[model samples]
Target: MADKSSSNAYWKANIRMIQLFLVIWFVVSFGFGIILRPMLSGIAVGGTDLGFWFAQQGSILVFLVLIFVYAWRMNRLDKEHGVEE
Candidate 1:
């Protein structure tokens, strides 16, 4: 039915968005903070190396921003799919 297809589409889009955000978070928190720390050591932020900054603070800030961004985006997505509250 049309409703079922629409629901599937909505879920697909939502999952895609979540995957994208998760990749971003992983790259920031794990890649930069650990795996790529040596490469980023030359860069300074808030009196520490970029990697440390990401490990200690930058990733958290990015995650908080992502939370707000995800909420706003989901609201828009819901409205687009006629599922808004």
Candidate 2:
């Protein structure tokens, strides 16, 4: 049987990672793409405002990157917690 404390620690760590990724997703998709759009308007991106690029493409790219980052981090965490598959 797995040690209860170790299992708890692993779960906590997993949750933390998930939270971090969610925050990043929110920031890129909403903060940069919408709320801060006007501020980014002056910046050029593919002949349009930076905000447009973010809303149309940047957020998706960032999300993809975050997915990989989360996976990589979780893999390491799993190994550290002796829960790797």
Candidate 3:
């Protein structure tokens, strides 16, 4: 495309998406897995401590969703901005 603003729009959108996802990822893994885990120790998941579940399983699930969300959003944004190529 000859439009520079359109290219910038794509970068900005992707940047925001990546930043938000990383923050969420950090909060779930480091925060729930280690830092704030004690506060959640009383909770259980599949008969295990919630923090342990987060460390072992929940983070993986979140990462899956994050990847799918990024793909879907990128596809939509690409079409919206005529940058699918």
Candidate 4:
């Protein structure tokens, strides 16, 4: 046997990636959602403030993008590290 314990490592790395992405998602959504909205009040896109869009929609879009990106990256990492199924 050549030893095959890479799966566990890949799983852990994937989990770490997910956690990091989630934390960023939370900060962008909630932190910018309310707590920091005032500071960002001056930044406007069209007629809406940055934070306003973050709260109402931007965060959700970012989260979705993060998810797909995470998935794609994880797949690449796994393939590179010889851990994919």
> Can you give the TM-score per candidate against the true fold?
0.91, 0.90, 0.90, 0.76
Model 1 TM-score is: 0.91
The true-versus-predicted C-alpha distance at residue 6 of model 1, in Å, is 0.7
C-alpha lDDT of residue 61 in model 2: 99
Please list all clashing residue pairs in model 3, or write none if there are none. none
C-alpha local distance difference test of each model: 0.92, 0.91, 0.91, 0.84
lDDT of 3 by residue, 20-66 (tens): 99999998999998899999989978888889998998989998999
Instruction: Tell me the lDDT of model 1 at 42.
Output: 93
**Sort by lDDT, top down from the best:** 1, 3, 2, 4
Q: What's model 2's TM-score?
A: 0.90
Cα displacement (angstroms), candidate 4, residue 63, comes to 1.5
Residue range 9-75, candidate 2, lDDT tens digits: 9999999989989999998989889999998889998789988998999999999999899989988
Off by over 4 Å in 2: none
C-alpha RMSD (angstroms) for model 4 = 2.5
List residue ranges in candidate 4 displaced over 4 A. 1-4
Model 2 CA lDDT for position 15: 96
Cα deviation at 33, candidate 4, in Å, is 1.9
State in Å the error of residue 64, model 1: 0.3
